[model samples]
Target: MGSTVLDVVNLIIARVNAAWWWASSGSSGPMPL
Candidate 1:
């Protein structure tokens, strides 16, 4: 049970980080891309 919860939390964090990276990439200027 605890492992399942931890796995879910890790997945959530990864998704959040990926979303943040995508958003920041879009928001950055062309120089960064």
Candidate 2:
């Protein structure tokens, strides 16, 4: 149970980081296709 929770938290953190990176990058310039 502890391991499963840790795995889920890691996945969520990774997704949030990706989204943050995208937002910051887009604000700097237009996104590429």
| Per-model lDDT | 0.72, 0.73
- Cα displacement (angstroms), candidate 2, residue 28, comes to 8.9
| Alpha-carbon RMSD, candidate 2 | 5.1
Candidate 2 clashes between residue pairs 3 or more apart in a chain or in different chains: none
- Expressed as tens digits, the lDDT of each residue in 1-33 for candidate 2 is 467988999988988777788787865664322
Q: Which number leads on lDDT?
A: 2
* TM-score list, all predictions: 0.67, 0.68
Candidate 2: regions farther than 4 A off: 1-3, 27-33
Candidate 1 has a TM-score of 0.67
Q: Tens-digit lDDT track for model 1 on 1-33?
A: 467988999988988787778687875643322
Query: Which portions of model 1 show Cα errors greater than 4 Å?
Result: 1-3, 27-33
